[model samples]
Target: MKLTAISALVVLSKVISIAAHGGVTSWTVGGTTYPGWQPYMAPAGQKTAGRPYSSYDPILNPVAASLHCNNDGNNGPIPQSITIAAGSSITAHWAQWTHMEGPVTVYMASCGAPTCDSVRSSGLQWFKINEAGLLSGTVYKGSWANGQVLNSLEWTATIPASLRPGAYLIRFELLALHQANTPQFYPECANLIVTGSGNAFPSSSFLKPIPGAWTANDPGVLIDIYSEAAKSMTSYPIPGPPVWSECRTLKPLSERC
Candidate 1:
């Protein structure tokens, strides 16, 4: 009986660990819903905007190629792109999210090609469009951007009103800080065909690469959010370049930004 109970406990622990992480399952644009890639299931060959990833597990290496999306996003089977007017809003629906201490960011990169299906994310230049971090309270126990996402199970980002029309890749990211010693990044990408007559594009200075934007020792990436020093910090330096000036103004999430 004792041995059986021990085995049962081990099995339950494994199940709990597996359920602790999650990934985006679908996206909504202009009242229409599109499915996201499923890591565990074979490709359904459906027309979707979301890109395929390897799993729901978080990417621990800041400089890994996987940082561009999650995993296998660059090489996986490409899904059909969705068309949306510039300045529209798109929402990502997660399978589940339990971590709360983190920032939520949205980035975009024009494919400069006829189709984004063949474009490699590494060669593209990315620019931040929206970001949210430590919204209230101290870093140790603040109302964070991920907390908002966790509460709603969804996160919405608006396309820049002045963005140029073209094929683009939109990246959605959440940086979980519960384990400050090792920051966790949950990133996903989707293909989009933005339609508009506007001709605004980010300058060279504003464009940043995924793995190049963050370093392992960056202050925001390596800080201890639960430490005594963090308790007194009212603001956090969200890791990444500033949002493009041509983009819409973000509602103040923190004074630091």
Candidate 2:
């Protein structure tokens, strides 16, 4: 149980990420079209609980946020956006849903807070979502989205080392839904932990767990993330020059849990 902040690893480049993070979006997956499926959860009922949903919600932390059903891309705050050093590799892995028990489709893009309509290259990565075991049909195998695009689920791109930091959001739009009418789905919002080059946390080496998988109901599991534990940089200060314009991204549900 250790908290790891990827940004706080070491101050090197520019600053980015400035917006409020509501909290994480959650999901429990199930489908048969694919071999073993990833975990997916859409808003199951008519109404959603809204913010203040998770005690550890990033919105409360301000540096992060989350959205669910009725979650239109009409300009929502971003949670867990941070700065990065040059030449850093940012990666992620996810699964999408077309229907409850069918294939899932997910699209990705790189945009800032005020306007997140910017579309970046996306991955065709596929993962099983049909009530599969846990991970890719293995233990700890559940992931959101349904494809085999590795870069899609996991992103590993290098920051320009001279890129600027600002408001950004990783839009997770659902191509399919369990029901047709409501254009909303579940969320497992990711918590971004800053890390310096070579996974270094220079500040005080403090590791604090930021709970991501908790719901309004259910027991809680915690994973500690170490940021600039000490007052190294300003609260969510922007990263320096040479940045990964769209590289600022997220983590997995199981790892957070």
Candidate 3:
């Protein structure tokens, strides 16, 4: 999820500097003004009272990512979304000036009707792990679509072959994060999906819960953990955005728990 100056909030975060206000700092969202606890932005209408939070500013496709202040703690997404193509690769980068003494792992899922990385599409076999689990490798998640190729880690990676597409879904997990002298906040999440081409694929036959594990994401799908050697991303779905409760339902979709 990227943020662009949509309404009052976006404008406030970008413009109106509160530097002159001493210890008190302010952040701008949609339109209303508020304190900067955790700078947040939603899909325009998703705004409300509270610390509107997000990973980074959504102005343009980010060319650089901060492993130090990302969601490794409990604020940002472990593996944020990105658009990629067929026959390509995407990597996850972190570890600069933070305390996250470990690396991140990249996981791939399937799309639903539109070729998501769910169990219904190609299953876990459709996904693969490069570099195994090397944060230093830089290139963690990589694969070939059909035509073009993706060679960069991003907030959102699209499938290549912009024309002749197939079924695919991507998910990332942060096994470890930078934990230095600062306290960081982000989301402990695992929501990585992308609608594929044509119609949805078949349902995955492995839809069942593990003996000791619990999850709200798609079940039955076999996920290929790029590397068990590296640390996995921590998750904290509680106390989410206000929109989560409103949009959440006991739906029987393949993507939900």
Candidate 4:
């Protein structure tokens, strides 16, 4: 997410200079970096901070249509999609996280067609692929930037071997809660064509639409991480829909987990 001065109330006493924000610059599979989105390309009046950069002023409200593609309302999909086999591992290299923290999760939404190379993420069906929430302890467990990848640039996740073969959109989201009073959300989407299939795809029960998936008031998205840190909290409530169970649950998609 982009760190707009207006969205965050920086504690002057905390630090002298605050340069925070980041984006997945390149996608690497098996140690090879592939082409990907131009970080911070969607927002209006954004400066080119170089490859793998974070944006400022994240998509504020979860229901906002801008949530897709990091509000890259004007940009389309990348020219080529990264190719990987089911159950393969991929890593996103960040320019830098700039001391930011929070839960970083990867999601996949099947484009209407088998390939999402040229398709946008407007109405796709998305499900959680990998999620690293508050790992353990209270010091920084409940915060996004405090997760295992804190201050680090790269995050890796594996494609489910059970995923059906085809092209899909791999969306990455980082919810920066450093300024706990008002959280910032940074979401990016990339195109991918998966080979070597599986039988069980994410059922409708586990899928959700981007803009409609989260709300500003959701407990996970709207919490005071700083306050929790002060009290030595133990657990955190992750925002958005629940992780899909291998056994389908006949529940309405609109109902949040």
Residue 116, model 1, lDDT: 89
TM-score of 1: 0.89
**Superior candidate under TM-score, 1 versus 4:** 1
Q: How high is the lDDT of residue 10 in model 4?
A: 61
For candidate 4, lDDT tens digit of each residue in 157-195? 888776778877787778777766577777776677888
Which wins on TM-score, candidate 2 or candidate 4? 4
Candidate rank order under TM-score: 1, 4, 3, 2
lDDT of 1: 0.84
Residue 188 accuracy (lDDT) in model 3: 17
Among these predictions, the greatest TM-score belongs to 1
Of models 2 and 3, which has the larger lDDT?
3
Each candidate structure's count of clashing pairs: 0, 97, 66, 14
Kindly provide the TM-score of model 3 when superposed on the true structure, using C-alpha atoms: 0.28
Whole-model Cα lDDT of every candidate shown, in order = 0.84, 0.23, 0.26, 0.65
Error of 4 at 200 (Å): 1.4
Q: Clashes in candidate 3: how many?
A: 66
Compared with the true structure, what per-residue lDDT tens digits does model 2 show for residues 1-257? 13346555433222111111111223211211111111122323212112112221112221122332122222213222333333343333333222221122222222323322231112111111111101233112223232322224422234333333332222222221122222222232221122233321111111111121123221111111122331232121111111212222222534421
Better of 1 and 2 by TM-score: 1
Measured against the true structure, the TM-scores of the candidates, in listed sequence, are 0.89, 0.23, 0.28, 0.76
Pick the lDDT winner.
1
TM-score, model 4 to reference: 0.76
